[model samples]
Target: MPIVHHRKPSLLSFPMWLGTRVLLRPTLSLWPLNKAGMAGLFLIDRAFAAGPKPSGVVRERMTLDGRPVELIMPSGPSRRDSETAILYLHGGAFVVCGLGSHRSMASRLSKETGLPVFSLEYRQLPQFGVGTSVADAVGAYRELVGERGYRRVIVAGDSAGGFLAGKVVEAAAQEGLPRPVAFVGISPMLDLDVGTNPDRSSRSDAYIPQNKVRELTPLLDRGPVPLQGTRRIRELADDAFPPTVVITAEGELLEPDAIALVETLDDADVDAVAHSYSWQVHAFPVLTARHPETLHAIEVTAAFIAQAIREAKDADDRKDQRAG
Candidate 1:
């Protein structure tokens, strides 16, 4: 996807101020969105759509499968034996968003954790479909972990990308692969079932088209391509997932999915935490550097990932000691 830059004199300060306003007013809590709310969402969507460059070392290219992918590395060296990495997934309702939309956020994540990131520009619905995109993600994971020798990989994403992140971890577990050490989903869309979550109805009031989610269900369930290829991405039970972190707006439509994920993960004995930010937009944490909620969310997420890495190292050392 092409990265679009905006030179408007006010582009930098405008959204920051507006985002603050939205964050502060609890009354804005799923308040009926007027034209202004829609406009703000539209403008922000445009900025993301225009593909703003994120601060980091971005390596973009076509993968062995001919799909375009981007690898984002933090701009510094780490002090430890490099073993941790994140496979980032971008959200656009499984239709619009791409690697570029999430570049800046991923760069910030890499900087905080001192780990490299591979932001997948997977295929989407309508044009290519979910099956193709899922396959591409699994392929990328195998390549990065199996061939490239990256250990302790994490799968991360926002919104629909979060859904894919969960799916990727599930697929990995099913294959009996070393599952990602962690999974972080920001405002994830987990369940494809419509009207399953009551909070969904309020989304239209918050400038999100909740009906669109229902509309997309059939197409999503249809296995966008042939079943043989699509079936590669498995739907795992709770046990077939890794430790997960979910961040979401308190009143957003997908809150139900997030809740269900936590319940399922808990039942399966997976470590999972879902942080709720009050009066925020969907996947609001991605705007972290400017937004406090986002910044806090990232801090929490980074801490989780770092702790997981430490625990894994400790366990390995214990195993070595026992063997020795």
Candidate 2:
């Protein structure tokens, strides 16, 4: 299915839904709080948000072009090999979050995908702009695939990271680098222009403050406000894209982003699918543990990755046979 909707509301998600509506949304809406204050709030939230440290996984610290990256690997036999891996970019609106903040999701993804995951601590706003972040991501991917010789790399991310992931694929294709086998964008912030339009469909989104997002745009990129548009992906040809999957929540602020991206990919004749769930907040897949829907989403993502890898390998095998 191109667009799957799971409208079953989960009681487990109620607290998060309520908290977003009453606490986080209002706090972010307060534009009076300067960048420092907003950043301070994010740091405070990161301090308290502890994710599970699952056992039997190895966490290694490494530096990619002077940027910090955490590599997560499962101890047991996984579906991974020297030629296959995952590169994960963490989401923080191009400001907050890092290896520490997103380690839980990386660990979980490693466990689920049976592949080592390189969680990039890319540069963010106020210090670096959108160009730097994209450069960092593309550089890391080159290191992994070109230098490390990983043949089946999957790029995955959530929120801002999701947007970065999609952009990485586009850039990689344009640069004639080794293409990723697939990509997964979980509630990506695709439309930088959404903040410009006052009549956004998700004005009442429970978690994200639309006005605050607009205010933060100038801080994210140096060259131009709204550095990227949602339709930029449309410029990529069908052959430039790999199988892609986008997961979004029903009432989340960026739901329209997910829809628009999928439609764009479809227009390019790229194999794209989207899953929308009811009563789930933004980045719900990584924000919660043991939520039935969260687990289901992970399973679905894992399956998609696995299928993409298989198809890639099969295509390679066919090419080899033809050459022989």
Best by TM-score: 2
List the RMSD of every prediction in angstroms: 8.6, 2.7
lDDT of 1 by residue, 1-324 (tens): 011111222334346435544563343335333334323443444577476566655455546245566666666554644777888888866666566567778878877777878888776655555666677777778777787787779999887787677667766766777888888888877765533445456432233455555555555543454323222121453565677778877666776667666767777777777787655667776654566666667888899898878877797789889999
Candidate 1's C-alpha runs over 4 A off are 1-52, 56-66, 195-200, 203-205, 221-240, 287-289, 321-324
Tell me model 1's lDDT, rounded to 2 decimals.
0.66
Candidate 2, superposed: residue stretches over 4 Å from native:
31-35, 38-52, 223-231, 234-239
Residue 245 lDDT in candidate 1 = 79
- Steric overlap count per candidate: 1, 0
